[model samples]
Target: MSENKNYQHPDVQKAENDELEIDWMEILRKIIAIRKTLYKAAGVGMVLGIIIALSIPKQYTVTVTLSPEMNGDKASGGLASLASSFLGGGTSSNNDALNVTLAPDIVSSTPFVLDLFDTRVQTLDGKLDTTLVSYLDEQKQPWWGYVKAAPSLAIGAIKSLLTEEADSTAALNPFQLTEKEATKVKGLRQAITANVEKKTAMTTITVTLQDPKVAAIVADSVVAKLQQYIVDYRIKKAKEDCAYLEELYKERQQEYYDAQSKYAHYFDTNRNIAFQSIRAEQERLQNDMSLAYQVYSQVAQQLQVARAKIQEEKPVFAVVEPATIPLYPSGISRKIILIGIIFLTICITGGWKLFGYSYWLKIKKMI
Candidate 1:
C-alpha cells in the first residue's frame, strides 16, 4: 500500500489537499481591508432608509370577520315543497350556488369594486369628507411613485392630445371603462381583500387606507354589500316563483268573480220558472262557479307559500368580528427599516469587495 501511494504524482496529491482546505485567515484579512468601505455604505444606506420611511404615507388597516350560513337540503318537508306538491311542481333541489370559498373572487370583481366608489368617507381628523372616489383620487403617495409614474403620465398626456378625452360624468360601463375609472378600480382592488379559512369557513375582509376612519367605514360597507349580494343570489329563484304565482292568482281570482256573477244573475232572473231546461242551466252555471272558486283558493294558498319560500331561501351572515378603526399604523417601524437597509448594504459591499472585484478584474483582462 505504501508503494502504491508513493506511485501517485506529488502534484495530484497537492491539488487534492488544496480542494479540502479553507483559508479562514485570508477571509478575515479581506473583511478587515474593506471595513471602511462597508461603514460608508452602511451610513449611506441609513440616510436613504430614513428618507424613504418618512416619505411613505402611514397606512391603517381594518378587518371584518363573518360567518356565512351554508345552504342545506330544503327539498324535504318544507311549506314550499308542500305547495309545490299541490301545484304539481317539482321540489327545489339543494342550492349551493354561492360558496364561502368564492368570496374572494366576488369581492375582487370589477362590478363589486365599482359599487364601492359612491360610499361616503371621512378622515379620522374630520378634515376631509367626500365620496370614496374623491378621497382615493386625492391621496398622497411617496416621492418615488411620482418619479416612476412620470413616463406613464407623459404617455397619457400625449394620448389625450391625440384622442378625444372621455367625459368624466358619463355613466360607467363595466365592460368598457374610462382611464380614470380604470385607475380607481385598480386602486380599490389593491386596497381591499377577502380571505376564507377552509377549515372554519370563516371569511375575513381587510381594508387598508391612509385614513383610519375611512378604512373602518369601507370595511363595514364591504361586509354589508357582500351579505346583500349573497342574499340576492340565493333567493333569486324563489322570488321569480313568487312573482309567477302572484300573476296566476290574479287571473284565477278574476275568472272566479266572473263565473259567480253569471250564476247569481241566472238564478235571480229565472226564480219563478219551473222548467227542467232552466233548472239544468242554473245547475250548470253553479258547477262552473264552484270549480272556479276551488281553483282560485288553491292558487291563493300556493302564492302565500311561494312568498314564504323567498324568506326561507334568504341567507343570513353573523359577523364574528366587526370592523374597528386601528389605533396604530400597521407596517414596519422606521428603526427596523433603517437597520435592514444598513445590514443589506454592508453585506452587499463586503461581498463585492471580496469576490466581485476579483471576478471583474479577470473579465476585464479577458476582454
Candidate 2:
C-alpha cells in the first residue's frame, strides 16, 4: 500500500481469483458510445420525477418544541415515585421522572395525543378549518360516507382486488358527523399519530390532511394535550404520596397519645415517687414523646412539600419551532425516483443488446 506504487500486493494472490465487477472505464465507454440513449433516459427520469412531484400533492412539515419545566418542584412525581420505591413499590420511574429531558416516551403515550386524534377541530375560532376534511374529500365531492360499521381487518389483504366498499354506505365521521356519523369514522385516529423515541424522549407526531394548516393544528393540539397530561399525572402522584404520609402521621400521633395515657396512669397510681420502676417508666415515656413529636413533625413537613409541589408544578411545552406549509412540493425524493428510472432503462437497454447478439448468432449460422 505504498503511495508511490500502483502494483497490487502479491501477498493476497489467492483472494484475487478473478470475479465480475462494475467496470468504470467500460461505463464511460458506454456513456460515450450511446450518449443519446443515456441522455434520453436521464432526461425522461428528470421529467417523470418532476411530473410525479407536481401532480399528486405537496406535503408540509411543522416541528414543535417540548422543553422540561424548570420549577423548583420540577420532578415531584419522580421524587414521590422514588420514595415509593424506597417503600418497595416499583417506583414508576417517569421518563420525565427527574424532568431531566423532554421525555418523548411520556409525551408519546400522552392522553393529549389521543385527545387531539379524538377531538374534532372543525373551525379555528369559528372559521371553518378545512384541513382534516380535505383529505377525506378526494375529488369533486366528500369521499366520506356514513358507515354502518367498520369493515373486517381481513378485507385489507384483498382490497385492491375487491372492488366493493366493505362498510355500509350510511356511516359518517363522528367529529363533523351526526350521532349516526360517529359509527362511520373508521381509523380516523390513525391519521393523527405520534412516534416516541424509545430510550431518548424526543417525539414526532403527525396528522395527514389535504390542507397544510390542518396538519399544523393537529400537531400543535397534540403538544398541548401532552402538556396537560404531564401536569395531571404529577398532581395525581403527589396527592397519593401526601395521602399515604398523612395516614402514617395519624398513626404516629395515636402512638404518642397512648404513651402519654400510660405515663399519666402510672404516675397517678404510684404515690411513692421513690419507686425505681416508676422513675424508669417516666423516663421511657419522655423518650417516647420526643420520638413521637419528631415523627409527627417530619410527616407534617412532607405533607406540606407534596401539597405545594402539586399546586406549583405546571408543565409546559414551548414550541421552539413549528412546522410551516412547504411552498414547493416535498414529496418522495427526486433522486430516488430518478435512480429507479435509470435502473429500469439500463435493464431495457441490456435486453435490446442481448436480442441483437442472438440475432447476429442466428445470421452467422445461416451464412
Candidate 3:
C-alpha cells in the first residue's frame, strides 16, 4: 500500500514512457534511405525557383525621407493673433491651429497620388520616357492576369463600345473612376507607400517599380509634390490676408493723398491771410491731414506685416535622404527563393516517403 501510494499517476507515467519511446534512430534511417529522393526533390525545387525568379520581372525599390519643419511657433503666432481678435485679448495664446500631423494623410490621399500620374519618368537606357500613367499601363503583367480579369476585360470592352466619349474629368473622381484611371490609381497605390514615424515625426516615402531609374524619379517627384502641397496649404490664409490688406492699404493711401491735396490747395489759396475764421479752418484742415496720415501709416504697416506673415508661414522641408537610382535591382531574390523551395520540397518528399504511397492507394481504392 505504501509503495503504491509513492507511485506516480498514470498520465505522468505514460508521458515519461512516450518520451523514451521516440524512434529518432529509425527516423534517421528512413531519412538516410530516402537521401536520393531528397536530393532529387531539392534539385527540382532549386531549378523551379530559378525558373520563377528568371521569369518574373525584376523590381527596384527607392526610398526617400523628408523632415517637415512642423514648427508650432509660427503657426501659434498666427493662431494667437486670430483668437485675440475674436476674444478681445492680446495675441499671446499658445494654441496651435495648424495640425502638423496631417502630413502623412496628405501624402497618402488619393488626389495627391493621382497628381503624380502626370509626373514624367525615363528608363535608365533613356529609350522609354513617359508619364507615370503611361508607364504603368505599358508595364508587362503576369500571364494569370488575363485569366483572372477576363470578366473585367469584357466589361471594359463593352463600355468602350457603348460610350462614344468618356469624360476625362471622371478620372479625378475617386468613386466614379474610368477603367484607365482605375488601373493607374491601382498601380500608383501599389507602387508607392508613405508613412510617418511618431517618434521622430519624419515622413518616409518608398517607391517600387520595374526600373530603378524610374523608381528614383517617381520617389523624388512625390517628395517635390508633397513639399509644394504643404507650402501652398500653409500660406493660403496668409496670402489671402495679404491680398485683403493690400487692397485696404491702397484705398487708405489714396484717401490720405486726397486729404493732403485738399489741405495744400487751401493753403495755396489763402497764403499770408490772417483772419480768425481762416485760422480756425486751417487748423481743422491740418488736423484732418494729420488723422489721414496716421491712418495711412497704420494700414501701410499692416500691409507689410501681412506680406511678412506669408513669408514666415512658408514651411521648410529637409530631405533626410534623397532618392538615388540603385545600382543593383532589389527584386527577385533567387537565393532566398531557392532555399524556401528546397525546404518546402524536402517537407513534401519526406511526406511522400512516409504516407504518400499509402495515400495514393487510398485514392485508388476510392476510385
Candidate 4:
C-alpha cells in the first residue's frame, strides 16, 4: 500500500526526471549553430593581434648586480682602534647613515634621472649617436599614439603661441622643473629601476630601452653612480675630519718651526754669555721649543691617522654582474599575442552562446 501511494502520477514522475537530467545533446546543438560566428570572431581577433604586435616597439633590458659591504666600519678594529685611542676614542657614526633600501627612491629621484639627460648613448646599429635627451625627444612611437595625441598636441601648440617662450638653455633646477623636463624625468624614471635585497644587501639596477647598447650603458652608469653615492655618504665625516686635521697640522708645524728658530737664535747668541740671566732665558726658549715640537709631532700623527681613516671608512662594492647588452627583446612576442587573442576570442564567444544568449531570450520573453 505504501509503494502504491509513493508511485503518484506517471506525468509527474516524467516531469521530475526531466528537471533532474541535463540535455547534453541540446547544448552541443546550440554550440554548433554558433560555430560560424565563433570562426568570424577568431579571424577578427587574429587581425587585431597582428596589428597591435607590429605597432609595439621591441625593448631591451640590461641588469647589473652589486654586493655592497654592509659591515658597520671596516676600520673599527686593528690600526683604527689604536688611532681611535689617540684621537680620544671618537669613531664615525656615518656608517649608520648608509641605507641601501633607499636605492629605488634614489634612482627615481628627479635629480638622478635628469642627470642622465646629457649622458652619451650610441645605438647598436651605429645609426644613432646622441645624448639621452635628444634620443628620447626623437624616439619612435606607434602610429595610433600620434593619432590619439593629436588633440593634446594641438592644445599645447595653441598654449605655447599665447604664452611667453621659456629659455631652453637655462640650467635645470631640481627644486623646480619645467613641464617638458618633468615629463622627460618621469619617462626616465620608468626606464630605470633599482632594487635592493634585504637579506643580502645586494643591489640590482635595471635599464630598459629600445636600444640595447644604450640600455647597457645607462645601467652601467647607474651602478657606478649608486656606488659612488654610497661611498661618499659612508666616508663624509672621515673626509671632513681629515681636512680639519690637515689644517691643524699646518698650524702646529708653523708654531714648531717658529719656536725652533727662536730657540736656536737664543742658544747661539748666548753661547759665550756667562750671565745667569742669559742662561735662564736660553733654558726658557729651549723649553718652549720642546713643547711646540711635542705638540706638532702629536698633530702630525693624528693627521696621518685621519688620512688612513678616510681609506678605512670607504665602503667597498663588489660588482657581481656587470651590465651587458641584451640580445633578445623583452615582453610578449607576436606569436604569443596572436595565440592569446584567439584563445580569448573563443572563450568569450563560447560563453556568450552557451549562457548569455539563453538568459537574454528568457528576459525578452518575460518582458
Which candidate leads in TM-score? 1
lDDT of 2 by residue, 299-329 (tens): 7666656655566545555555665543443
Position 236, candidate 3: lDDT: 88
lDDT preference between candidates 3 and 4, better one: 4
For each candidate, what TM-score against the reference? 0.89, 0.45, 0.81, 0.87
Per-residue lDDT of 61-110 in model 3, one digit per residue for the tens? 99999887766655345743554444443433234455446766776677
TM-score winner between candidates 1 and 3:
1
Residues 1-367, candidate 1: write the lDDT tens digits: 7779558688988977775554666788788888899889999999988998888888999999999876677767666777677776556667476888999999999999999998999998999999998999778899989999899899999999999988777777999987778988999999999999998889999999999999999999999999999889888888998899899999999999999999999999999999999999999999999999999998888887787688777777999999999999988877888888889889889889999999999999999
Q: Encode model 4's per-residue lDDT on 1-367: one tens digit a residue.
A: 8779777698998987786565766777887898999899899889988887888888899989988877664445735556767765455444365588888998898878888888899999999899898889767778898999889789889989999988878888999987778878988898999899999999899899998999998898888888787788777887998899899999999999999999898888779989999988988988999999999988887887787777776777899999999999987887898899888988888898899878999999999
- Identify the leading candidate in terms of lDDT: 1
Off by over 4 Å in 1: 2-22, 76-91, 161-165
Better of 1 and 4 by lDDT: 1
Candidates' lDDT values, in order?
0.89, 0.55, 0.80, 0.84
Model 1 TM-score (2 dp):
0.89
Displacement of residue 305 (Cα, Å) in model 3 is: 1.3
TM-score of 3: 0.81
Worst 10-residue stretch by lDDT in candidate 4?
A: 89-98
User: The CA-based lDDT of model 1 is what?
Assistant: 0.89
Residue pairs with clashing backbones, model 1: none
lDDT rank, highest first?
1, 4, 3, 2
Per-residue lDDT value at 130 in model 2: 46
